[model samples]
Target: MSGGTWIAVDGGQSTTRARASWTTEDAAVAGFIQTTDGFAAVAANVSAALAAVPDAPGTIDRLVVGHTGLPIDHASRDRLARMLLADHPVREVVLAPDEVTAHAGALGGPGVVSAVGTGCVTLAVDAEGRGHRIDGWGFLFGDAGSAFSIGRAALEAALRSDDGRNPPSSLVAAVHEVFGGSPRDATWALYQMTDRIDRVARFAPRVIEEAEHDAAAAAIVRHAAEELAHACATAAEALPGIDRVAVTGRLIAPGSRLEREFIDALAARAAHLLTVPSAGSPLDGAARIAADGPSIYRPLVEILTRPESSAA
Candidate 1:
């Protein structure tokens, strides 16, 4: 097997992280770089990430990229691989969806995993290695248990309360305080924001804080927890004989109400599963894939080493 420098990248919606490592028989050196280009501009983002590595591109042996919004079709994957290899001189490259790396990093084996942050997604891998994905439809239609969802719910409730369509709550006052205007003015201000999804998601922490003393806010948080738990349960069911589940993302951070409510909801479902926190970051999983070659995503990864070896 070949052993040299390798780069691993975990590109997500909000931030992109890359790690460059030089490995020998018994030791390794590593460095990290972070960017905000996200998956929408994956090509440019990846190029920037690669350039951040301390070592020259020609000296790198391999690069494994697990990216959000990665194309699923083989043709598209090949096109992307070509684009990346055009500028860098890495010997081999492997690419797959970010969830594959998340699953590997969170569960490491056969189990279900729920990743909740700006968005939420649940993935399950059975003992037989069959994979199932639940939700993660993005901010517009899905991501039910995500921070974006919670923040949107809070904003809607505040708006409804202002219009006399819902009961008055602390959220209404909080919104008025933060946005600083009448309902119409607040609406106008929101529309002016460049990144509305991220701006709206900023209210998630406020929702959690208010939920400690407000009924409406508490209900929103609990419902979000229920939604996340349900996704986990559904995925677990799809992957039979799996009794372990891992939860990641900032929404369910330790010592938070969201985490407590999520656990309680799971317990209510009588799910005979061992729920645990993730052991490593997605970049770690990407590194593992680079070192060991493909595993679960063997069919999805494209190896762009030789000119003729372009397909997965």
Candidate 2:
């Protein structure tokens, strides 16, 4: 194996994590750091991660960063690459969308990956290496079947129940228990919270819990499962020769009712297809891409790997 230091970073909107490994002909050492997200925040975390190792900035060979809000355009990606090169002494760097790394970690090869967390997005890669992305339009217009969606639905149901527009539901009681107020008061408070999306998403587990026995909650869960399954199936259909779909993110935790329903719904739509479980975390995928030289992120990798003079 080649002897050098490699760094992998996963930068989400909530938190950022970086792993650094120094490998030589015989011995190797690894370190990890956690910090905030964003270009500057991730760079700072990367520096802190490398601080424990000797000759960090100068001796680093490769760095791969999968960030949540990275730009999709080539010019924008190149701009970010230049910024990273200027900030660090690493020989090469690769920047990719966090979803790409999530798909890589979940599928590791050609297939479809549906990530349902605070938000939802589905990606499919064809046999010929073409990619299709679906339903990542953010929380306002899209992100169907996400925790935020489920939570929002629950809140709506609770409000309807409180106002006597909908039949009384266990969700009303559940919402009152958590938020300690009437549905109207809870709704107003949700609007007042700074991180309303995340705060509202915090109620998703409760929705899931109530779904076990509450008809209204069960309806929300079923609807969520249907929406998520539809996204996965839609993406899969666009990618010819793909028979496997992998699911990632907190919303699809194994053995949960949500997962069971989602898989069943998806299986019904796509015959003879497999729902593969995620084999590794996104950080593992980032490391794999860094070690493998390049794949989907070849453009960014090439731009960063080129000599400074050539780049100029």
Candidate 3:
């Protein structure tokens, strides 16, 4: 197993990826190959990712993965673990949620990372290595701060306004503009598909923009940030050693007013807000796990702190 290859599989709600790297006594090559939405679509991309990595040079030993949207129960994690072990000759496999890799990639020392994208999750880790999470619930129950959640909320608000039942939202106007001045067009597009999380989430940025100029939109943004911050605080409390908080996601794009408000709320709570040098991609963190194992959390600090790189 010494001098053997290391493999990593990162399964995300929106995408999945796999990579392999050979190690020496020095640094590793940024040998990331490709990214895929295989796990979400079908098995073909996953098979291709697996074929990309040759068997380990010596005896194949370990495989590590961070899977987003995986069932939180032991039976589910165990089943995925069995699949990895069965598919390859690796001696050991570690199966954990994507939040673990996000924490490893974003938080340094002791801090909380609120990740908001297609979904939202807050992860915290203390110096003692204990971890905590909050608001990782899927779109239906929670995900209050997620892109999908915000977009869904905006749609509901817009529809109510359109129906003359509820007050109008800037979201309606913004969405109307996006769909050629017809909110009905947008509605039809959203309703045309049963699985529209991604399509709806595409409206979040416009919602945020309108929120900056409209009171109703601003209210939604404020409420969303508050919900996200609360989730981060919950994780922080569980990790008493954490004094800093970091926020990441396309929703909180750098220098955006929403991100500014999120930072202000964290400051009000006395949580030092630090910039997490953009969490490049989950696959990068998964590769880190493959090369260094779970205990190598500290070294990940370097990867997360480096200047933002293109998504792997």
Best by lDDT: 1
Write model 3 residue lDDT over 176-262, tens digit each, in one string.
776655566677887776556776777888888888787767777888888877887778788666667777666788887679777
Per residue, candidate 2 scores C-alpha lDDT tens digits across 187-233 of 99888865677767778889998999988899999899988788888
lDDT of 2 at 125: 78
lDDT measured at residue 27 in model 1 versus the true structure, 0 to 100: 16
- What value does the lDDT take at residue 309 in candidate 2? 62
Looking at model 1, report the run of 10 residues with the lowest lDDT sum.
24-33
Cα lDDT over the full model 3: 0.64
What's the TM for model 2?
Answer: 0.82
Q: By TM-score, rank the candidates, best first.
A: 1, 2, 3
- C-alpha root-mean-square deviation, candidate 1: 5.1
The per-candidate count of clashes, in order, stands at 0, 0, 0
Cα displacement (angstroms), candidate 1, residue 108, comes to 1.2
Winner by TM-score between candidate 3 and candidate 2? 2
Per-residue lDDT of candidate 1, residues 1-312 (tens digit)? 235667888776666777766522211222112225333356777776665656553546777888766766778777777777766776677886777777777777888888876777888887566788999777878999888899889888888888889888888778877668755577678888656666677778889989999888999999999998899898888867888888887667887999889989998874587888788766677877777676665643568774545322
**What lDDT score belongs to each candidate, Candidate 1 first?**
0.75, 0.73, 0.64
Candidate 3: deviation at residue 44, Å? 7.9
Considering only N, C-alpha and C atoms within 3 Å, which residue pairs clash in candidate 3?
none
Error of 3 at 14 (Å): 2.2
